[model samples]
Target: MSKSEEASQRPDTPHYENATGGWGSLKGVSRILADQKPTFGAFRTLMRQNKPGGHMCTSCAWTKPAQPHLFEFCENGAKATIWDLTRERCTPDFFAEHSLTELRGLSDHELEKTGRLTHPMRYDATSDRYVETTWEEAFEGIGAKLKELDPGATVFYMSGKASLETAYLYALFARLYGHNNLPDSSNMCHETTSVGLKRVIGVSVGTCVLSDFDHCDLILFFGQNTGTNSPRFLHTLKAAKERGCKIVTFNPIRERGLVEFADPQNPAQMTVRPATRISDIYLQVRPGGDIAVLAGLCKRVLELDAERGSTILDRAFIAEHTTGLDELEARLREVSWEEIERESGLRRDELNEVAGIYATSKNVIGIYGMGLTQHVRGWLNLAMLVNLLLLRGNIGREGAGISPVRGHSNVQGQRTVGITEKPENVPNDKLRELFGFEPPQEEGRSTVDLVEGLLDGSVRGLVSMGGNLARAIPDRARAEGAWRGLELNVQIATKLNRSHLLPGRATWLLPCLVRAEEDMQATGPQAVTMEDSLSMIHGSLGRRQPASPHLRSEVAIVAGIAKATLPPNPRVKWDEWTGDYGLIRDLIEATYPDKFKDFNGRLFTPGGFHRGNAAREREWKTESGRAQFTAPEALTALGAPPEGQEITLITLRSNDQFNTTIYSFSDRLRGLSGPRDILLINPEEMERRGLSEGQVVTLECAVDDGAERVVRGLRVVPYDLPDACVAAYYPEANPLIPVSYRDELSKTPAYKGVPVRIRTDEAGA
Candidate 1:
């Protein structure tokens, strides 16, 4: 049989099997190093990949100038760059040769072989292929189809990678269309963080700016892996470490990046010994047990203050800037130490030590990522973090506040630009003042709601801005199946992805200019603005040439669609905005004058500028004129695994991967190579299940839904994970996540915690 045929026949064929181990475990580290011998010659090529300004990875909003000299680039970022710069092209001929049904059966890698989409393509069911179509025709068809559906039936999904300008235009277009169904990537990840933070402090964003990192005396990291997810964070962490700021980490895994990292940028360190310690204190909190760990710490801090007679708890700030402290304090005191130890997998001494650090630190910053937010009670988890900070008067102070480390470069910026369905509390009456339209006050569907609506057939149309929605959402099969039901699906992307394969009845793929590639227009090479995690907004101009002359900027695409859909609409000046991005900035300046003063002028400045928050200086924006304390009870612990299930499985992303895009077959940081099928299990759990390291096992998800999805012949490796907890790479294990399982407030799928059964596959099938 042919290799492809054999792969198809094997029921247990491992996806990226050869690339499945952690970076530390990848074979012959020396051999790889030898093959990748340090060479300044290759540096420029690698650096160009890192260039921000050129066609930006539509997968990520990372921006940089296309410099001639070598610069910093991660493995995944490199893959994203090459993926965009591939020689392959998905022309009309390629599509004509393959049927949509045939392509659906092909693996993600095989579909990618069709290559870059050179022109707008429309699904032609009669031919069973995608035929090249003009941009105008594509937009007109979409608009006409959308006009047929109830405005509420159309769902607009925005990815984190979209530029601020693009997001603004997209949101504006959606509003004009009369629907507020703006579901975004944030709904899947940090909606809880945004919602929880906003409810407590009246701001939906992190308070600390990048400069705040420099001023911090202590940095507390919870459930975040900085090295693998956000490599750029290493630079900030390194600086903080050098500045004598104590760094503490709380996570289940002792990630190498959190412990020691070889500074690629430091010449002296690289030449001599290139090891730098990252985390001053590492606490291995059990998975799904972050609340216990936090509660213990809070309890200890209270005890310490009472015994030592220290003013560790901010009495004046709490009274003046917060409410509901009595109830919060009552719950904190009621939490038993026994439960804390059992749930958090930490001893009493450890909790006390963490509390000591918090009490002693004059200025502290708490940084967290998705690990704390992709759980059943993610909102409460965020609230706990906020509670800790509020108790210490950390927020609104120099170098002190809760910071949720965002993934994409401008994910936060997208929110700032109004890619949110939730009505802004601080009404931009300016939108009414300028646009002559009253922005809807009603809340709209979030990402989870979008998927639910799709599944139920309430949503008939989907317009995505740069993301693989099918692969990114949990329960892949359900998401993919629902995607097929859409009446019209439009994707503005840089490259092909799994989501593209799950086409709607009438699907259109519109290729757009990448961030690294120049976005030239009638005016000239236009620079787009993006805000970093620190609230700093800067202009990014592409340096490299366009990928294709046919490609359009996201801003242009949004404008084109809006103009084509709402022809002669006097409320929107689509023609004027389509040609220049500065006009959009002017509108933004008008809307958010307090923060975006001289938007165009300030964005041109070096390193851009931060949107100064008066709240950062202790001004309360909450309803009560103070931060509100959220009282979250220790909800009944996640129930134990079913009788037949041996262990609970948690899905996670590898260092080489970002969300849904698999940049490479290997996850170098996790000792994985050439495969992504290995499962990490606790040694004790493995022994209990009669499994050994490298033993192949079949894992079955025991979800509330009756549907059965099995991942077979997964190599199990015993590791230091907590008892009863097992970890597998995501998307592959996404099937285990049930559509019904989600956080109460945020509605984010609990991708981090899933219950499953493991057993030896007798046939190894």
Candidate 2:
């Protein structure tokens, strides 16, 4: 029953203060259409979610708008399509009336409201529950536990909600069942924006193109919150502030979704002009202060480029397209504007007014999130924000680049179709010249080496393919005790989270079909494809049908577990690739033909195509053929607490939560109601910690070599956070951080700057 016993000491508080979107985004879209009291077949399955004829809103990656907006979903994408068109049902007699230990004391939002998992069950273990079965005996008992494990002891993971034809046929059936170990959900949030934008801009997604935030004239956002993680990126920052741009905003928690949003399709913000105020300059900084406010705005754009008429950088694109510019102007003159104002609580006159609005912006861009990649030098805070957007030549041309505002929606197309755990340099020779084998060249196992290979037993086997990894990992009793020390887990799900109640010694589940449903398959009616976060791709097409016709369609349950564990293959043809997902997009365009070229005729091209960016055409595929400049060394602070009553914290996602979906424990833009054991904190550090405002407390935080991290009770509230900062909500403070804290060069989970220390609720009074 633990994931910190689903945060208790309930404390409601909320009385409106988070000023984002008007009528609080039409009351969080009328409380997700009154908790999906739906049916006109769920209102025609919410008019095909992101509509280009159907399905796309796998929540937030905010892209779709190249002229298409008849309500392209977004109240958290209409509560992720009313939390997957829920009408409720766990079926098979609700697992013969509940028992995996009474569904492990419920809450992972009450096991996703006890709904949707329909058929394929398994786990009997002398009737501890979950019985139903047979999709050919649950794919031959998970292909006989992948033939009694040891293709480096099974891992797979995936889950940024699958599709890109089920993560390229679940990495071509775990590299034709020998295992590349895969790992994904981008190894826990933007694998430091794909290994720090592929080492400072060669590639690793984000080159900008949501029309580059509409002709960028200046738009920063480092460590973004964009009105609660992509509240439709505040209508592209309110149409780039009515087209005269200049946004700014870094965070520590000013967020009312970045100060002013209100577009419930604008009724002039519900009667007369006033809700589009998005940041002109907000800058709170401090939780592992974005590489000392990007090294004091790249050392004040190198003292305004050494003053002789003050040009401010771009010395012919840093001597022809980059390469460590004089060791980044000697590590920004050996750090010290008093250690960038003691590690960016900001002010060297707010880093020269943010380097004079980034040296008079001639097309800039930046935007960031996960507070610049959950730190431990989150890949040197995205290489000091690409060394402050290459000091001026703000990435590849017109209306600038760099974006990284990621968070699901096809997790950059499941790591652009292959879901790596490092295939010793991806695109494994275009998947060994279009699947003739030779792929698993080892080096795999990421979601932090599969929870340290399920706590050193060398990982025992889990398939996952849709995430809830014991409530999104980061130590919650060591990721549910290494997912209850797996023996073979499986899960290809649609609902019921808490990693499907962790069982394993062969636990199963299956279920599936949810990108707005209907996937007729056997070649006659299916559609798939995903990618967005501006690498575009598109083609969703679900059009609502399978509420539970025994579900299956995460590309037919990874093609029925790859034709029940591959014993005969004609160089890969799993039942004519599970009745043609256009032959798995023609073998993913014969394995990445320069990014799926004409991949199904660009789904009749409306707003799809782009997948382009190698720094948008000034190419530079690193290893010396340019674009490098790294420098960053003065981190100054994030945890030197001893004289401060230590705080830090961060965590996030409550505006009706998304990743690890919890649609409404009521977070109407942070007024928060029903309760997820609250936290927030800094009203002058709760009057310098005598603490009050709904008190409760308890937090703790353990890290130097892990374990003992706390949590208990919580409540607190006070907020407008900063000194000794604090904030909570995430699979409820993901059990106070430490699943090996992280970012040893992008392993990710430092879940937004955690340090911790609160206390007083002493085991909840």
Candidate 3:
């Protein structure tokens, strides 16, 4: 059998399609708690997952209310906490028992759940094990490698999960070292929002805050699984529903989160089990076809405007605060109804129904997720959302604007605190003022570009501040190979992951403090600041003991490396900065003065203060000095596959998964358990492809690159998805996607839309 065919054979697990949240979530929480078997020490970490004077859930960015409930967390949130705060340890002894080849063959869940790294380790290629090493030796080893390479050849990849304090020092060290190759997790998720919002609105930040959900006349949700990905968001959505606001959704699959939800917090929901209908109009959209559905709505709005004039379309606001409407309307009017129906997988009447709800509502808040951003035309999706809201005069209103939900708890905060590859975003003059050095002026590389650099032999060293970059990127095999070819690799993480296994010529595994662990520094127990999806910056102070005595804070790790690599009189006070985290915040405030004014006082604010949004106050800071109605002059090129390919593949997160982190093997909503080796295919398509339930199959990429990218051992399962749109778990299927498949504008991998061919694995038979 071919390697691809051999790779396709694996174990089997049953899937259970069950209701999301409610009693099930309670049971899940109980099971996880029992798994932790939290002693008083672990119990202390559990109670402080998301409370005042305590750390927020590091899992999701759903912010806590100013007056939050005593328990403002969910089952998944508990999983993230206990997983990070686990007593289990993967010490050097464990590494001695497992070889590199042996560890690579383990499932992602098994590797992470094995537990946190107890000490620093250096890969011993001779023995194929990671042996314990002193902190000084590890730093010196990494520092020596850094001194040998051009700073530009070193890539400092930052995870969105890194705290503001850590990100500040990481970016500072890289810039001071004369390079800006700081790619972040945003490149894989919402970089489109930052690019698109800045193109349309004056700023990349969201205009709406959490309170806007309370007063919105309508809630338009697009492709977000709130129940699983952001369970706390269900509270806001349910509240909107109870207020008589119309809710509409556009998704490729009918997510249970959108269909119906029972508030786990409400006592009545436990017994009555009455589901609050979330979406009044749920349209099953086709992958990468959101534009057509949105354009159809806008086209309908134009027809209404033609009949009764622009009053229903916010003419006054359009005239006063926006430009490009005539161009937008002209293009929208040209779209044919047939094309809309065909591309969107919905009829004209169904669209007209949504148009009716949208046309009548006075205030609307648009919510979207990776579904909108991870596409070839992902930025256009955001543009469409902005155009929809702009047409309705939703900006600068009581309950209106766009809300782009983000994943990691502090992904936005990383970008906010100088985690960018674009030199234009670095504010060189400000850095010169704060650090007494001219920052590097050259533009840096993003994640995709970093992979390209690695393959082309430019990136020599890598310092990843949390994340399994090797498994997280699209082309896993290629990413794995390129990183292994690097001269040096350093990973600062809370737990062991696949990236650790991809050792360069020299590899160092350094464990860092998680959000729950107490961070003591020269000043005192340090507090780190984080920004949420809503652009609220607040404090996160650790309270629990360090998971391992040898573990260091991310801030300390960065400082230690900086001390080893840089000159004796490096202008920045590395020791002082690490000693007091408040100094880091003070430096940040100095760097971005206007944005961080009163930063200290606001850290103690009830729910953190807003970071100043232009659109929120009806302030337009664009070159035209007004919010603009942005519409594409024409439809983008079709992203569909050619004659050979029949299926469109989407990578999905099971209810138990968090990004690339496999929290559990079972998925609550998908009814999948034990194994994540199955693919969700449309029943009719499965039969046509000569496949059966539990029958192993191989998925082949259909691109014309002359490269056959295939993933094997996929257990087929019939599902309620759009025809020819199959779903599978990522990192497993990551190898099947080419790294070249990404958004042109934002450079984000188009994880949602991969064209592939499926065939039953009758190879050896």
Best by lDDT: 3
Per-residue lDDT for 57-124 in model 3, tens only?
88888777787766678778888887777778888899989998899898787788778888999999
Lowest lDDT 10-residue stretch of candidate 2: 2-11
Query: Against the true structure, whose TM-score is highest?
Result: 3
Cα-based TM-score, every candidate? 0.90, 0.35, 0.96
The reply for model 3, stretches above 4 Å from the true place, is 1-19, 633-642, 761-765
Write candidate 1's Cα lDDT for 1-765 as tens digits.
321122211222122222111233223223333332422323333454434432233333322322322544544454555555555677778778888787778665556645667788888878877889998898799878877877788888888877778888888888777777888888888887777777788777788876677789889888777766766567677788888898878887666667766555556665565466777777777777788888887888888888988678989888888898889878877778898898888788878877898998988998988778877788788878888888889999888888887777678787887888877532447767777776777777888778778878898988898877887777676667787788989988877777877788889989987676677877777878777666767676665656567888888888887777764756587767877888888888877788789988876555457777655877777778788776667732243433565466667777656777665566655555656787887666777878877888888776657777677868887665667778888778776677677776778788776677886868434
TM-score for candidate 2, residues paired by index: 0.35
User: Among all windows of ten consecutive residues in candidate 1, which has the lowest summed lDDT?
Assistant: 2-11
Order of models, best lDDT first: 3, 2, 1
Q: List the residue pairs that clash in candidate 2.
A: 21-262, 22-262, 39-42, 227-257, 518-545
For candidate 3, the 10 contiguous residues with the lowest summed lDDT are 2-11
Kindly list the per-residue Cα lDDT of model 2 for residues 313-362, writing each as its tens digit: 87888788988878977878887888778777776886787688788789
Candidate 3 yields a Cα-based lDDT of: 0.81
RMSD of each: 6.8, 23.5, 5.0
